[model samples]
Target chain A: MEPVDNRAVVDLLGALAYAELTAFDRLAEDARLAPTLAGRAALARMAAAEIAHHSRLTDRIADLGIDPATAMAPFVSALDAFHNSTRPSTWLEGLVKAYVGDGLAADFYREIAAFLPPADRALVEEVLDDTGHSDFAVREVRAAVSANRKLVGRLSLWARRLVGEAMSESQAVIAEHDRLAELIVAGTGDLGGVAQLIDRITSAHTDRMKTLGLNP
Target chain B: MEPVDNRAVVDLLGALAYAELTAFDRLAEDARLAPTLAGRAALARMAAAEIAHHSRLTDRIADLGIDPATAMAPFVSALDAFHNSTRPSTWLEGLVKAYVGDGLAADFYREIAAFLPPADRALVEEVLDDTGHSDFAVREVRAAVSANRKLVGRLSLWARRLVGEAMSESQAVIAEHDRLAELIVAGTGDLGGVAQLIDRITSAHTDRMKTLGLNP
Candidate 1:
């Protein structure tokens, strides 16, 4: 790994931290869509996990002697817009968003993490560990679809719309943060490299959707 | 402490677990009312802590070979009703609920926790430890009230309404659960004893309200 600009690193951490915060907010609200207490608790647990991840990133940014709020400010609007655009209309839609939408975002971050210095890479990897919640989302979504076959079509369409909105928002954030863009480009070795990185993310996202019986 | 019925203990733990889970849901939703990222993260942290406590209670219920969902099912409607009736209208309202409303509930739970056997009592006390988030709520609510004097009257009314609904819901739950009623009566020594215990809790609640410049 090469030396990354500290400002760029902070930008990345800020984006990650705010992402988790907003994810926590969205998942917590979506948990309300659950028809059962156990189901609600499951989504709340996912929301809790996001906050735990948010804390790690925020703490790191604060350790850098920057106000976490200031560091997180830049990415808030884009992420908030992503959540606003992709608000789930039903319980199954919520589950699919938790699974497909968040999974793609996590994959993109993990890929970005790889080109950073060791410590930052490690932090990103640790916080992006979505394995437990991913399994929960997949199980719940699959069970629901099995019980109501018609939900499969609505959820499949929801997954694609979620990914599209997520990517659009991601692009908007990247465009505004030149330092962060430079860092990602450097990490991946070039803009073409960035394209290749996103391609790998897109492929994994397809697999995730397929696992949930939804189209990519 | 005397040997207590495990059935009753499970009942108590279940209720406590569900309370934490519901509180987590409410607090996480309320976090969106925060005006800034730091403020949002602060409320989310409180929400996260509730889930942590919920996990502790749920695990204990499962260890007793009782399904947590089954145990928690009985108390769901009352709690959901209490929260539904007292949903916050503003960020300050949310903070007041987190402060006064949750504080009152915690005090009542702690008082009731005393009548159980040592291990169960300890678990109750541990899970009811809301000191970290309580301090944050107090600081935030007090600051907001200081900024607007007329805000005091509305908030005081809000606090009163919260306690009234909480008590009504609590009475409804207790009336149905004889085993839990027995546990509490045992802890307090008698019906009169339970009254005395509630008095102590109410007094503490008054002090809490006064601390926030609100009338009891």
Candidate 2:
């Protein structure tokens, strides 16, 4: 096996850590859109789970002898821009975003994880674990969509927008961080390899959207 | 001791449950004001802790055969009003509000806990545990104040406004909920007992402010 690139690993961890932090922020913010106290609490619990994962990723980054914040700083703008541009306007939109958006990001990260050493791979996978949010989002969105079929169309469009914004942000992040881009290219083995990776991610996202009864 | 007042117990739990939920919301929102990612993560972690406590309180309320949402519904308006009235405009104000505001609330709740049965009191105390936010807020606020002497006046005023808003909201809540008021009166033994409760909470608030190097 080839030796791991420490800089690439740091970039991956940093990106993941900041992603979790923002996930926590956005999820918590979206909880306000919940129509019921129970719904709000469910989203808040999911948000809390993100912070726990964030702490784990940051701890691993520190174990690598890098300051977690310093490592995370470079990716902040791109991540913030993605979230800002895709802010959900309604409760179902928020749920769909949490499910579809996070599902896409998790799938992408999991693919990247295969390139890391075993320990780092395990860390990435663990942090990306669904934290029961998938079930909650699925149940909520499915129930809502079933009650009002009109929601399917709006939410499908919302999901597409989420993916589009995420793709642009991901591209920006990769373009700005050379080592991170190298890690991706190295893992995929070529530009074609990267295309195949996106294919896999897109396929997974379609399955997720179908599970939520939304159009891919 | 007198038989536990089930309605009062439920009301108290409901109030605390909603309070924690809003605390989670406000703290998570305030995190965006943090000057650094490390500072942001610290606030986000504290916000997560509030959700954990909220879960526990809601669980106990459920164990008593009450729907958590129904129990929490009564206090939502009061709690929301308090938070809306005192939204912090800056990072230091947010820290002071978290420290002084939460410190006062905890002090009051602890006093009320003494009036409950052992098991219920234990639950209240457990959910009200500091969650490490106290030290973080104190350290940050004190450092900020020391570095800029002019901040003392602004933060002190902010702390005072927090207490004032909290007091008025508490009055509204107690007046609105008859059983909760009975719990306080019965526990304190009379109207003077209620006065003393406020006195104790106020004194502790003053001490917390002093600890943060702000005026009471």
TM-score winner among the candidates?
2
- lDDT comparing candidate 2 with the true structure: 0.92
How much TM-score does chain B earn in each model? 0.96, 0.97
Clashing pairs in 1: B115-B187
The models' CA-based lDDT, in order, is 0.87, 0.92
Model 1's interface RMSD: 0.9
| Per-residue lDDT of model 1, residues B1-216, tens digit only | 456788988888888999999999889888888887778889999998898889889888889999999999998889989999999989989999998888888888877777677888899999888648678778888888899899999999999999999999998998999988888887777789888988898999999999988888
Model 2: per-residue Cα lDDT over A100-189, one tens digit each: 999999999899889999999999999898787679999999999999999999999999999999999999899988888888888889
lDDT of 1: 0.87
| Pairs with steric clashes in candidate 2 | none
**Per-structure clash totals for the candidates:** 1, 0
lDDT digits (tens) for residues B58-90 of candidate 2? 999999999999998889888999999999999
- Give the alpha carbon lDDT tens digit for every residue of A1-216 in model 1: 568888888888898998899889889999999987778888899999999899999899989889999998888789888999989988889888898888888888888777677888899999999648778788888887889888878888888889889888988888988987887888888778988998899899889878997756
